[model samples]
Target chain A: MLFDFEIQGGDFATAGNASSQIKKILKQLNVDHRDIKRIVVALYEAEVNVVAHAFGGKISAEINTTEVRIRLVDEGPGIPDIELAMQQGYSTASPEVREMGFGAGMGLPNMKKNTDEMHITSVVDEGTTVELIFFLNQTPPNH
Target chain B: MIVKEIVEKLNLTVHSGEAGLSREITGGYTSDLLSDVMGNCDAGKIWITLQTHKNVMAIASLKDIAAVILIKDLKPETDMAAQSETEEIPVLGTSLPAFELTGQLYELLK
Candidate 1:
């Protein structure tokens, strides 16, 4: 199954809408509880990234029998330093965002920690695309 | 312990989602950062934070948390309460700081 959701920038109110829908679908599909938790964590962080930093974005989630692939494309003031952004405690969120308890600089790092495979690409003045892949129906890995 | 018992013992005020009081509390996590809780908090845990935004409820629901306790007498945003009702996750409040409340909850659950 494939699903798409729109993300509006600077809109903290609806930040988790996409994650919420995806979570419901995963539960209905009877995805393993551990995998579902990781998926939701990664996706929710990505969704919040778009809401907190981008102009707007779209999320495409595709679920197959063995895995789930999610792509988040955003129009925003793109990250100039992908490596730095991936580091924990690195963020450029506005003061207003920080005040809301969301800009603690853990989003991307958490995203990487939860996904099985991830890729990110961005243009300084244009946008960013983040891909997260998770292999499903597998025994939980020791963490 | 169940969420209902926690409320009674802690004197937490129920701000929304009374139906969820019956839920079980397996553990507790205290963090003001949304990503901190989202990334690390386990399911069925009770969250203690000062964040009152509507997205807090979103995380609480998605994470399958038993309940949320807003610290320092902070109240949920208008839409936050509504979302808690829809998600059936109770939002509780206390005048205690996050530190005090967290320690108390930890002692109770342990």
Candidate 2:
């Protein structure tokens, strides 16, 4: 099955709606609980990143019996240094975002931690796209 | 702590899901950011926040939070209450500020 959501920036009221719908779909499909949790976490983190940094974005999820693929694409000031942004504790979220309890710099790292394979592509002035794959057939390696 | 005790001590209104007032909450987390709440909060804790949005219920459900307390008398829209009911998570409202509620809950837990 496939699902798509248009994430609206600056709309704190509806930020996590997409992730919530994705979780419900995974549950109805009888996806493994552990796999679903991981996917949900990664998807939510990506969604928050889009809301915090991007102008707005789109989240798409493709689910099969064996794996789930999630894509987060945002149009905004792209990451100048993907490596630096991926580091835990590195954040550029504004004070307003931080006031709402985000911007701790854990979103990207947590996304990487929860997924089996992750890829990020960005152009400084254009935008960023993040792709994450979580395999249902394999156990999450010991952290 | 039982949800009833929290309601009594905090002087909160049962906005919805009164059936869950007897539910047990082992701990409490107070944060307005849904991300931090999702990352650090364990299941079955009472989530205290100033946010009054429908998505808050989604995070609580995802994290397995027992109940949600909206501090400072913040009120969620009707749709948000409906979502909480559907998720089986009780939504409570309180006139106490977030900091005061946090301290009060800490004392109760202690």
Best by TM-score: 1
Q: What is the TM-score of each candidate against the true structure?
A: 0.97, 0.80
Per-residue lDDT of candidate 2, residues A1-143 (tens digit): 88889998877667778888888899899987778778888888898888888999998889999989999899999999999999988999999887666888888888888899999999997899999999895875662
lDDT of 1 by residue, A1-143 (tens): 99999999988788899999999899999998889999999999999999988999999999988999999999999999999998899889999999988888899999998899999999988999999999996764664
Which one wins on lDDT?
Answer: 1
Query: How high is the TM-score of chain A in model 2?
Result: 0.95
lDDT against true structure, model 2: 0.85
Q: Which residue window of length 10 is worst by lDDT in model 1 chain A?
A: A134-143
Interface RMSD of 2: 2.4
Which parts of model 2 have CA positions greater than 4 angstroms off? A140-143, B9-11, B15-26, B50-55, B71-88, B93-110
lDDT of 1 by residue, B1-110 (tens): 89999999999999999999999999999998888889888989999998888989999998999999999889999899999999999999999998899899988989
**Each model's DockQ?**
0.90, 0.45
